[model samples]
Target: MLEVKLHDIGEGMTEGEIIHYLVKPGERVIADQPLVEVQTDKMVAELPSPGAGTIKEIIISTGTTVAVGTTLLYIEGEGSLEPVSEGKASETPKEEVPVLLKEKNEFVSSFNRVLATPYTRKIARDHHINIEDVTPSDPSGRVTEEDVYRFMKGEQLAENEAVSTIVEPEVLAKPISPDEIPFRGIRKQIAKKMTKSLFTIPHVTHFDEVNMTNLLKLREELKKEGVHVSVPAFFMKALVFALKDFPVFNAELDEENDRILLKKEYHLGIAVDTKEGLIVPVIHHADKKSIQQIHDEMKCLNEKARDGKLAAADIQNSTFTVSNVGPLGSTGATPIINYPETALIAFHKTKKVPIVTENDEIIIGHVMTLSMSFDHRVADGATAVAFTNRFASLIEQPNKLMLEMI
Candidate 1:
């Protein structure tokens, strides 16, 4: 028999919520097959099988949060210990990921069956509602936000019994909206992580306006030959180049040791907004990819992120994060750090502005704000200023970026 333990999904991710199991006990699995889906504070990922064998038992279930090194499952049979020598590299398995619950059954009243965290359950109990009566929208039938609203309404109804008896449902209401949304699965994990991020970290933001007129002109000139370019692709390319010049921005923080760990490779994370929430998919070795390659890869990652088809690997190991709010008409924003990275850069809406040249010539120019948030503990004001200045210089000099590309 062999046990598969959860390894380090990423730095600082000590625990993850088990979303679900793809395979059941007594089922056959191949080497590299995904056994469980887990949602960490940073991203959602699938844990894979190390060897081909018959399934033995599942140690965790949907909605249960387990820590790193937690033995998730056991496999029994031939080669389970030795591991199958399949030379093929594992790809994230393709499957319809259900939201953080098992198959829906009639609601259970026991607190054990409720998928809420300790705090949520406490709130529900204080509100005097049966937790089971709250219907969950998640595939696991886990209670959600709407469920809480419903329970609260039930409490209000009990308090105003006289009005409830007189009010006719059809006469007073135009379709009662869903009342409670249960906190279960990835959504629940996202909430927990964001709450922790917001509260635990003292966040501050700095903003600057950048003139991208030259870069835009260069991109338009390239578009004639069907060499399409996107703003993010261009920004990422320039940012990577700037990082090479200003290495301090690329470093991560080791809080316990009170040291800065500088990274050699530039892995840029493109924040992909989805229906579930915001997911940042990392493009590994981003500095090495061409503009076309970055464009194509970003397209694929963003599609998967939106479709919820992303695997665990899709969301791991980002050295830096970029949150582009230009698409949403945002001129500027204060972005929260992904943590340990020490900084995050946000792209804002680009527009035209008037500029006066050294020769006393005034002309219309394009401008955009590049907002940056840094961990004060790691990066000082001087370093942040130098990094942003270098980045802005590169963006202004489109020819330099083009030459670096060649």
Candidate 2:
């Protein structure tokens, strides 16, 4: 028997929601053919058949979220099959996987005869609640994520209100528009990240305005000289210098080691809003790249993000992040920091507005507002203010930004 479990495909993927199974039990499939469609926190992936065989049993039902190592299904290879050899399971007989739950039962259960996913069982274990006693709202007797949370709230099992679990993956024929959106895939992943960042980090956001007159003028000048670049690219270059001055803002808190580790390399994460959700693609070592290089690379990353073609490497290891929402027409926003990264800066709407000059004169200038959010535990407000001020100065005088290149 071939025990096919969810493979650890990428960084930070612990579990995935079974979207649908491409193949059904008792169906013969070829090697590498997609067996099941899964939606992880990162992307939608197809778990393929280990070898050509007939799918024996689907352990995890559709719409259930299970941990990485939990078995999804069993496959009977052609002729005599070798047992699973990945771990200690190799020694265990194949009978456990096929017959542990039951022959005719649709819902698979753990050794305790509890119809619950590994994650649901984990929740029960963490709270010291015996999962066997919790009444499943799923008519099939399978426990759900919400059922566990409701139980924690002192909700009674007999009054279970969790959504019905999908027992078979093949019933759903086509995607249909529904009024209520199921918060399971990317949205759920985003909620988890946002909750973790908000609860764990002490957030402090500072708002400031930048004089974009010089930067815009410089962009035009460069364009006239056949050197094309973007305004955000220039802003990113200016931020590199500001980060150099306030290195603490670019540092991550090593909670385990009880120290703040300052990062020397500048890997800037650019947050791009897509149809699915907000995705950040990193520009590694931005400090070493020119304004044109930054512009070109940022464009390429943004395109890939829109098309949903960004790979795992495109989004990892960002020391700091920036959201340029100016084109989207936002005056300011308190952007969330990519967790583990100390700070994130958002550039908002730029408009031709009246400016009060130092010489007591009013002049029309291009101005953009910025919101800088940082982990207050790592840096103080005074430091954040100085950092934004430096960024503003660099934009006010492109020559100083040019000097930063040197």
- Scored by lDDT, the top model is 2
lDDT of each: 0.73, 0.80
- Model 2 gets an lDDT of 0.80
Q: Give TM-scores for every candidate, taking all chains together and pairing residue i with residue i.
A: 0.68, 0.73
Clashes of each: 16, 0
Top candidate, metric TM-score: 2
Ten residues in a row with the worst lDDT in model 1? 96-105
lDDT by residue for model 2 (222-294), tens = 8899998888898889888999998998899999999999999999999888756788889999999998899
Model 1 residue 405 lDDT? 76
1-406, model 1: which lDDT tens digit per residue?
6677777777457888876566788877665777776767645567777865668888876778878888888876332234432332132123411211121122231213456433344346557666677777679866755677777887787778866667586546777678886676556766776676666556667778788889888888888877887978888998898788777678887767888888999999888876566778889899889978999999999987765566567777789899999879998777878765768899989889998887999989898887898777666777777788878877888777788878
Q: Pick out the ten consecutive residues of candidate 2 with the lowest summed lDDT.
A: 103-112
